[model samples]
Target: MEFSQKIDVNILRRTTFSPRVKNARIHVICGPMFSGKTTSLIKAVKSHQKDGKKVFVFKPKLDNRYADEAVVSHDKNEVQAYAVEKSVEILDYYLNADVVAVDEVQFFDDRIIDVIEKIANDGKSVVVSGLDMDYLGRPFGSIPQLLTIADEVTKLNSVCTFCSGRARFSHRISEDNGIVVLGEKDKYVPLCRSCYNELKDK
Candidate 1:
């Protein structure tokens, strides 16, 4: 009778591990111009408010198209927001807020990303809305990175002016050299890929 070799079971023992669960999260609503990103953001804020959550809204000072201190959608839906010239200024009014909403995120500097991330990590929910791409179809400021780290992303679409197809790009009708030309229907139109490419080629 040969004795079988005994396996060392103790060596297989592993350390106890548990992943950290986060209640707070980041939500992003992004798309081209006229995609109703602000509308979605407002809806979210109202929903949270109905639940008795303390919500705070912030918008860049540069966006005074509708109101000096309010976030306004194309359809005239408006929500009061603190107008801040710098991203860090948002922290001044974030006290005891359960939910934070940011409109026109693309207008803010890159520092906005860090500020938003910090708010989320501190157990406060964050909702952000902005254009994902500029007129040239390039990723706008800080939005691409925000999309990557966001827990949820909603990409809205608009009707193409040239065609009835879903528009995913913002085409600048005006011949402006600068990237940031602040205007509404007078300057920009929504276009699908085919229509945008056609117009771009012309």
Candidate 2:
């Protein structure tokens, strides 16, 4: 005769609220490709850590440009991140965390707006970084809307590949007309408005 395994079904529900987490505020960091958006976001997270705040970093599951468990910068700095397929999932992870950061905000759907807003109102810091425009020079989905709700907005600049000027646009050279595309250094180049217009004119 074989014995069946018995499982414990009694567990206590969590109901305590954390006092360390304060009022939530949304921070948006946006720019074109190579504009150091991710770097700036990581810096903010590190600064929060230095202040003795409990911090959590997250990225969209669609962004596989870097490792799934960490957000890596061009300068090789690394920060552990939780990868979720949907922005709504972030709320579940914030239960006990003091600060919540979301990278690649552009990839998330419209629902992210309400989620980010609600989280911020609950007394936690929400930091988001993403490309403001797609390869077609159009606003990349929820990024523009998120900017409106953010408490602070920081726009970064990258070096234009053609003229070494301040790059403000991400020029898409690939055939993909869709807003979302995964690419490397060979796929897109940074350009200033003038240079970008010139390139499009050709």
Which candidate has the highest TM-score of all?
1
| Residue pairs with backbone overlap in model 2 | 22-123, 23-123, 23-124, 24-123, 24-124
Tens-place lDDT per residue, model 1, 31-81, is 988989999999999999999999999998888898998888989998889
Candidate 2: TM-score? Answer: 0.86
Q: What is the C-alpha lDDT of each candidate?
A: 0.91, 0.86
Q: How many backbone clashes does candidate 2 have?
A: 5
Candidate 1 Cα misplacement greater than 4 A, ranges: 1-22
Q: Give one digit per residue, the lDDT tens place, for model 2 in 42-87.
A: 9999999999988899888987776989988777787899999888
Each prediction's Cα RMSD?
A: 5.5, 12.4
Pairs clashing in candidate 1?
none
Q: What TM-score does each of the candidates earn?
A: 0.88, 0.86
Please give the lDDT score at residue 45 for candidate 1.
95
